[model samples]
Target: MPMLKYLIIILNDASVSFCHYESAKTGKKEAGMISYDNLNKAVAFALKNNLKVNFLYPRFRPGKKYEKLIEDVEHVKIVPRKLGGVYSDAITVLEAGDLRKENKVTGTENIILRLSSPELKILPAAVKEIARKGGRINLVIKDVENFGDSKISEYRKLLAEISGLLIKKSGENSIPEVNFLTDRLMLESMNNCDAGITHLTVAPDGRLYLCPAFYYESGENSIGEIRNEINIKNRQLLELKYSPVCRICDAYQCRRCVFLNWKLTGELNTPSRQQCRMSHAEREASGNMLEELKKKNFKGAKGIEIKKLGYDDPFEIAVKNRYSIQEFKNFNS
Candidate 1:
């Protein structure tokens, strides 16, 4: 049996976004206290499974009763550090204010900054300050479903503006890494969000979910009780091979989100055209960013060669590759 090595438990209403893109409107009620009975039970489950647990927090205060439980467990909180004192890698909820003044992130923490179309265009300024902080930055686009061929050119131009800053750092021997345009260049294979494959999430109700959003979007989607045994149907569908667009895709940086897949396509296995094109634009941007660095005599990253791809969507190429999508599933199975 394949064992789950990581477990995520949500404790509050306003959990941290971490490195993932969070939906602006999550239809969840306030983060109520799970009976200490349940919290202890969940921790015991993690201890028995040999899993690492990361706890999620809300903006509202956690009662004193919950403090000792927090101290006892090994978990990370995702909250907005700038609002006051709540810390532990704040999720940059929006990009509306002075990038540096609004977010003077300490040098040793991680940040998840979410941006819409207009906000992303102004990312060059934020990227420079973030790189100077000596911490990692992940840029999450809010409206990927809106990206199409008409907007592809605009996205590429924005990447050029950001890449110019990144390439200049090469001269300084600085590794200013940005998720949208740089991560793909360095990843050896797929770094997709391992939703149902490797880990599971436990909601405040003490039920297991594929990830947080699934638990919040519709309560009925909960997988199973986390204490005794866990069960899932169509488990293979969560793997890369079952995804037609992602299986043939080389944009290893894309999340290939399972919840987003269900939301857009109604089928967990199918990927939307918008998602594929947006990721391809990102992949192409990284390719161009690499070319800019090479002019300054910047060598390659690791052993992975990021070959320039001709088309943005791999499904288009899958039509031409002798090994169709059917063959991919066969090999993985």
Candidate 2:
């Protein structure tokens, strides 16, 4: 049975896609938006299946017909900051270009700061400012695979600094939610993006995809069409528990992005060194932050603990143990 919890409707071909995988190479074409007929069908699908809709917007204002179609559904609007109405939506995603604008952090119940590694190093103050306004911050690093040694060090130091900032900003009583660092502290099980498992994307082509990146990167690779049923071949592979390394790993906050996995390792279940190491660093940072929060006697944070691990990458440990993927299945079983 397909547990389709989210219906990610891409309004146009040029809609703002995911921050990391959607590079300049995947620029806009003149292909146009999803047909109003397809939009209505998708919305009907969401309503019939009880799935929440997340509408990805284009840079320009949509026409009245399209706007009216969008208004028919109770969906979350995902728009670029320049398009305005960031304050009213359930979530706001910041592209790297959005950071170039003037600092004006006033919007939404949640804000996703999508930055490259270099951008994150200088973004602590901005993150703190955003937190001051009381909206949750989800910091998404676009270029995770390209993190050199210096960049890795900078990431560690930055997390430490931001953890303290969050502590101070929330005072002694509260813990402000910062996805990169603080999310791991509270997560007990894998709280990954769960792309194909819990969510699916519908591109302007009226095709169903695993996620937005799959559609944005290549529409020809669609799993199914909106007019018919969704056909996710070997769909079990998309779940976290089916992942050999991820099932045993305790880095719960890792997005385990299926798109990133397929992009780097040629398999949706297998993760790259960059993903594992960066996630472990954040996990360790969360551990340290949790300890400090406990020391301050913060409620609900007292019993939380992220264990210390020797190796950052789980693949290295598997190699050391001479462990095969099959061994992981048996071990986890």
Candidate 3:
């Protein structure tokens, strides 16, 4: 049985689906909200499967009925920062294009900032402001595939600058965690967002998918419908142990988005070069930050070790050493 923990429900077909790949919301608007009957069934399916639901909202407000149905169960709601209230307590997700330094994001406790590669370079000022506001930040790169090895220094510099700003703003208070850099410090093994393995998504069409991206990208992307049994063929592809390179890699904070794997290499188990290198760079930066934090008397990072690696992409090293599938298991053993 799949150890399913979360069910991401895209409330409408038009909901903002931001990540490392292209936007799931295709051009010109269309009526995309799922029928009330379908949504109720979806919620029932979640309860049956013992999975927590997470609703992804679009620009418009859901009707009273939809709202009540969503509130009936314990679930998470992800809405655009521009959507204002209704789901004010929900996790606010912002696209880089939508944020300005002057714009005030009302409730700032847990915020997700989405940025493309180019926007990432110019957003230190905005990030500093967010850091000053005192909340947890998840800096998600929508176009991580564009991140090149040459830009590793820039990425590190940005992380260092953000760390400095966050430390300065907090003064003696506990430093709020930064997802990309600091997450690795606290993790001992691969702690990726196990998309298809540990989580599943329900689309507006009432079909279950590996994730929301799969639903919006193509209806055929769905694994099964709500009324039918939840089916994920060859489910092992979603597990980390099934991945040759990632299984041995120590970059515990890498998202390891399976959708990106399918998008970049047309294989669910393989990862792209950009994904590996960027994750390694973050890993290296986190290691440095861990050492720096230990010096500042942050004992939580004590005894953490992230060895210096010559290759940013583990696949290169594995290939160079002629590592086979059995060799990966032996290395970890």
Top lDDT model:
2
TM for every model, in the order presented, reads 0.86, 0.90, 0.90
User: What is the C-alpha lDDT profile of model 3 across 186-242, one tens digit per residue?
Assistant: 787777778877788888787788987777678898888775455679887788767
For each candidate in turn, give its C-alpha RMSD to the true structure in angstroms: 3.3, 2.9, 2.8
| Model 1 C-alpha RMSD to native | 3.3
Candidate 2's C-alpha lDDT? 0.76
lDDT of 2 by residue, 46-138 (tens): 877778889888776667887787777778888766565733654667765665665655555477778887677557766776777776787
List model 1 lDDT by residue over 264-311, tens digit each: 889777777777888888888788877667666676564646687777
Per-residue error for 311 in candidate 2, Å, reads 1.0
Q: Record all residue pairs in model 3 with backbone atoms less than 3 Å apart, i.e. clashing.
A: none
- Whole-model Cα lDDT per candidate? 0.69, 0.76, 0.75
Where does candidate 2 stray beyond 4 Å? 23-31, 320-333
Q: Compute the lDDT of residue 76 as modeled in candidate 3.
A: 85
Model 3 TM-score is 0.90
lDDT of 1: 0.69
